[model samples]
Target: MTTAPVIGPEERLPLGAAEADPRTATRRRYLMCEPRYFTVSYSINPWMDPSAPVSTDVALRQWHELKATYERLGHVVETIEPAAGLPDMVFAANSGTVIGGRVLGSRFRAVERAAEADHYRRWFVERGYRDVVMPESINEAEGDFAWTGEVLLAGTGFRTDPGAHAEAQEVLGVPVVSLRLVDPRYYHLDTALMVLTEADPTTGRRAQIAYYRDAFSLGSQRVLRHLFPDAVIASDVDAACLGLNGVSDGYNVVLPREANRLATELTARGYNPVMVDISELRKSGGGPKCCTMELRD
Candidate 1:
């Protein structure tokens, strides 16, 4: 992968104005759940406020739009039945990470989400995929782990344990780059960084990523700078709105409408910035990426 210098100050653009680049034509399979059981039953992150009222109806509508957008882009959208009591199950990305058809299921740290780990594992196994459930450490699957084509970018210091890094490396048979999550707001690595693509279509190299620098520890920040020097750094306003929690299919980046600055930067990069409003889901500290999980076949 080629590295460029860190981004400098730039002007923001209007939301959803970015043109889609045809070069980014990679289609992926994704898993999602309707927000039928979604609600802020408890506060696990800074974005969640238990006292705040949640509208399940509005949440479902927004989630539907997100699914429609993915389908419009020619990506396969699969469903996992939402259980009655697991409100947070709508955040499908937390279930696990799938690479090379192998699944490493999550072990949620929060008591409320503990049961979800097994449910997700069963779904993968039932589909005939190999599922490995970590027996010892706490790890929230794709929430803290990202695949960069060549290596796995694992996050620690907030939700996932550092010990899982070695385990992930052993299980996946790939090198793991352990990045530390320092900010309370961006608790998960997926919330702080969005993997744009696994490989650049033109260069045939590791694809790019966009991230919030302030969310990582100094050492992790250095690693990001060294590895993805040209990564689009999210502004405070965009980062605060959960803009980095996005899903990309090489050409189009699907993110929140509030992330105008991020949309502008992505537009300038010869890629498409597909914006969607999932404000209702944000009450539970998630956005577009949280609602979807990439399943490699």
Candidate 2:
């Protein structure tokens, strides 16, 4: 069955300056859903090893520990019901991009994940979010779109279309910078780059990023270097363990325990690295960031 694309404007809007000043950044509130039906039933990305055995009990235990860690650090964590037949729904970051209480719902490119758009939309609406902008183009929300400093860093050349970059800018009312992914292993932008400080509230507009340079194209690498000269470049070993697929709160960076080098580098830069074991989820090409979605109000 063919599904008609959600009709919307597709023109690339003019890039604007960063939106919110990071100096006032506060503890971010996030949403996460328990892995009720989490399993790699199909091979979508390079990480999915369906032949390998999966332990739902282990995945649930790890997910709970991660949630507890967030609460322990004094962050508000919200939950949503995981629908059946949507195993990938555990990765809430792909649901949408939230800005100023508005959510630009993701229109997934994969047919297996297509139904996710509406489910997430209803969840937002029921939770009192009125401004939900659905897109016509294929964009994977926070998975392929994230905010760093005042601009939205969008990913393409894999799960997302370059045309969606413009749509996001127009709908989200923030300037978006495009980054192209080269490696199939790092199919999503979140897997290649991690936002460290989105406008450090303590310092000011100063922002930081941790990324794997080789995951991007030559042009994208140049753009990243020009934009963030002091960006933390992850080692090949760390990147292999999905170290770049992490979540940061401007103070604490939550990553997999396998990312030892990244943790050391983060500590050297005066950032606390909280290691968690989400190896079960890693079997599906996701990590800390994939399990959480920041909702900025």
Candidate 3:
């Protein structure tokens, strides 16, 4: 994969009137898992260090605050019980990708997180999600797959397998655009990119996004530039803080408090930035988006 080119302020795309207009927040339905058994006892990604100290109590508190943030925004928040010994289960976004009541379950690349897929699949089945499917290929669900209204942007090269991209397209029946990730730090696509405003073909409102350009391969960066010309480009400081690992309901964006620069950029783009401190859970490399899974029913 080719390295991404350095983009300066002068090279940034100019914001148009449509981008400056105030955004509308849509009420959504989401699925979450409490960090009842949260911990970083095993190393999987670059953020995990087994030797580092952890506090389950702190993780629980932070996770609760995140859940409350969603409820406060008028979004329905549903939760699954955190299974014992499944430490990373709290990062529920990996559970699956639910679209129009059809669920595409995850097949985790790590053994430590493998069992999580079944639990999430069962949740959808038990809730009467008739079209739920457990993927045969290895994929990390929403952690590596993001819906942009018109197409699904998928990432591979670290956690999720490249083969899963085609598998998801067949399962969801939506066009999939494969983007290769080059950075290990941003192991999942959601860690390096986020969809800010989904496309609205009726209103001619194009999909808007924000991403860490360096996390993607050069060709992937070009694709992103073509798809979203006015996409927000995150700085190194914001990307390191997992700023791009945020959830946006078109208008209100919930993100980590440490990503100050990203918050400022979102505000300039006419989005309401809601900050939450989940530093305790960050020990395992997760944020708001990581903990929450949007359920499109």
Candidate 4:
């Protein structure tokens, strides 16, 4: 069997934009590395119904599958240590606005999850990432973050707290749009929304969000009016397939293989949607987006 040669950090996988070319704006590069995104699941997830996490073989296979997809899309997939006790941690990656390859590792809000932060921090700094932002007062989970290039939306009253958002505003130096997450079931803002395309001039396409039902400030239709006027409301199938949980590589979305109808509709509308088997993962309350940590250019 042909094996992939292990390369140095500089030779890490690179995924700029999932679309054919999502970097139309004046980004530093047409392609770049986003190694700060990921996911994790084990037998310990409280959200899982009657089942436990996948088997070690299944878990490792899924991890490798996601890693391969991210690498194919041009991203550096860095595997972190699995925390048997922290089921929500697999998606953990170094959180920060990437400025010249410097990653700002964040402090997690939940004490149970905070212990895992340092693991990623050391990982980033050891790899030569400078300007790391470990906020003294702010604590955030990587899941609380979403990268839109225009705004960094953070959710409070859920896994993330207010202190983290306030500090992130100052630390990240970007507009911190705070939304009160209505319930804890949708752990973070990302649990509901993901940017599938770049900003559109006509309808502000990039501004359009493919989100799901969760406890948040804005009404679904109202959000559509205010944000994406020409938006696609996630169908029931999309919702179940990971309407809000999958990652988009220029509309070739990574969803549950069970969500073929959603994929077909998205494909008809100029998206190239794809799926991965996450039946076991979903039993634990996650899907494609839940599995990815996208660092787009």
Q: Rank the candidates by lDDT, best first.
A: 3, 2, 1, 4
Error of 1 at 136 (Å): 2.7
Better of 3 and 4 by lDDT: 3
Instruction: List where candidate 4 sits over 4 angstroms from the true fold.
Output: 1-46, 49-54, 81-88, 93-102, 136-139, 200-205, 213-215, 219-224
What are the per-residue Cα lDDT tens digits for candidate 4 across 63-145? 56756655654445555555556555555532433433545566765465666667667766776766677766445544666
**Tens digits of lDDT, candidate 1, 1-297:** 001111111212223334332334566899998889889989888999989999999999999989988887778899999888899999999988888877788888899999888888888888888555554688888899888888899998889999888888877777899999988999999999988867644666666799999999898899999999878899999999999999877767788988888987877776567888899999999999998889976
* Model 1 quality (TM-score): 0.90
> Which regions in candidate 1 have their CA more than 4 angstroms from the true location?
1-22, 200-203
Collision count of model 1: 0
Q: Each candidate's lDDT (Cα)?
A: 0.83, 0.84, 0.88, 0.53
lDDT of 1: 0.83
> For candidate 2, what is the lDDT?
0.84
Distance (Å) between predicted and true CA of 294, model 3? 0.6
| Candidate with best TM-score | 3
Backbone N/Cα/C clashes per model: 0, 4, 0, 23
- Can you write out model 2's per-residue Cα lDDT over 1-297, one digit (the tens) per residue? 001111112222221133232212146688898998988888899999889999888999999988887776557899889889888898999988999887899888888888878888898999889899999899899999979868899999889999999999999899899999999999999999999878645555567899999999999999999989989999999999999998877656788989999988876675567888999999999999999999997
Candidate 2: clashing residue pairs, number: 4
Ranking by TM-score: 3, 1, 2, 4
Model 2 Cα shift for residue 132 (angstroms): 0.4
TM-score of each: 0.90, 0.90, 0.93, 0.72
